[model samples]
Target: MTLSREFKVGLFIGCTAIIVVLALLYLAAGKGVFENLHAFTVSSKSGDGFTEGMPVVFSGFNIGKVQALELNEKGIVLIKIKIPDRHVKWIRSDSAFILYRPLIGSARIVVNTTNLNSPPLDEKKIPEVIIVNDINDAIARIEPALERVTQIADNVERLTSNLSDPKGDLHRILSNAGKITTNLASKKSLVEMVVSDEESVKALNDSLKKLKDITTNVDRILTKVDKMADKTDSEIYGKDGALPQVNVILKDIVGKLQKLDKTIDNINKISSDTSEGTKDLHILRSDIDDTLKTVEDAVKKLDAIIGLKKAPEFKVP
Candidate 1:
């Protein structure tokens, strides 16, 4: 059972072909050809710098590649990027895809994902965004910053010159600060330093002492005056003082006046009764004199009618 030489040659060639096929498949697998590929679309307003086969880079690593570009009726360029299934997690909902084409470098789609833990991007959503850079606009924005930087540099130069000058305000401030620090560290107190010597401080303390003594004397005098006022108030208002004695004297005078008024009324009544009794005695005395005269006349008539001689010589009264 020996094989032919042609058959052996054919067997060798067939085995070689099978090995080559297997190696090719292995190489393709290594390059992710057999791996699952996911697709997603992004839109751009202008497709000026966008091109197919552009590498999508994230954190300096290529995660995907741009597959196709199509311009729709709305003048938007729709870009489709293909990524291996394992790298799909890098495209988050919060991820940004920027079409950054530097003036001096090749154009690329730069993907930046701030939060890698966010939800995965929904591939079915349409009209995903891609930001493109404009060189003219960037330059326009940078011109003001350049001007501000120049102004800041000039201001720094001026500040440095001022700080370096000996006659400048900064130097004066630093010199004053040094002098103040030195004064503070010295044996002299701040008050002595500000007032220009210990002598002035001693004089101030002496004056303050004298003022304190004067205030104490005044307070003592005021206390004595207050005691005098209290004594005077007690003497005037006390129960046995001059005010109560004077009230007692006034009451005694009032009682004596009432007794004197009663004595005056009794004297007036006695004088009226004496006056009426004297008038009645005068009238009675006058009537007695008239009766004596009539008796004498009747005795002379009886002597004449009896013709009898009356004895003349004997005077019997």
Candidate 2:
């Protein structure tokens, strides 16, 4: 059957419309267009040149976009972000937001929310600025420190080069080591000469053996002396000794004293007999005196009788 031009035109138009609708649906899904969105506000000193439609990434995946940016009367940048409601729970009170520009990449807004138990962020809340405050100021501050590090490295390199030079003190130390080695090699014969004196070595060994023998003899003498001292002490201090002989001599002296006392008694009796002989001599002297007196009296009596007869005896012869 032959198709009419009007009919063909209408069929083509219908198919084209269906294809366009499907493409729009796919793009909207990729942009999270069908999902419910929540608005959160962040305030910062500066925007760091971030514009509307800039992606806001959570843990490296895009979760939202910056929908608007404005400045308040205080000149602070107010950023309004639209985040899908499905990911809104990830935005907590403790979450950190930063705008970072690395040395190699365009600036980006990063969200970090490792703590899930924190309180949820409120709607239209002004979030804190977490990164990239002043890039130019930081670079300016680090220039002097980097220059100092570079200067220190250059000084160290110069010192090392000076130490390695052949005419320097390190080279003189190495040359002295080589000279010492050469001197030791040339004096090998002197070491041999010192080791060759066998006679002196033998004398030293003999002296040591003699000293050992002397020590052994001294030990034996000490042992003998200790034994002799013990025996001498026992003999002098034992029961029968000179002390008992002295006691016997003292007893004999007492017996001689008794005999001397009897001799003194005999001498006293002889003295008494001599006194009796002297008394007898005095009695003989008295007897002689009495006999002489009697003779004198007889003479006187004869004289008186002769006078009375005197005239008759003269005539006869």
Per-candidate Cα lDDT values, in order, are 0.77, 0.72
The parts of candidate 1 lying over 4 Å away from their true place are: 1-3, 103-105, 126-317
- Considering only N, C-alpha and C atoms within 3 Å, which residue pairs clash in candidate 2? none
lDDT of 1: 0.77
Q: Give model 1 RMSD, 1 decimal.
A: 32.1
Against the true structure, whose lDDT is highest?
Answer: 1
Evaluated with TM-score, which candidate comes out highest? 2
- Residue-pair clashes per prediction, in order, are 0, 0
lDDT of 2 by residue, 119-204 (tens): 99887578776766356657788889889989998998877887888888878888987876676676445443344455666676
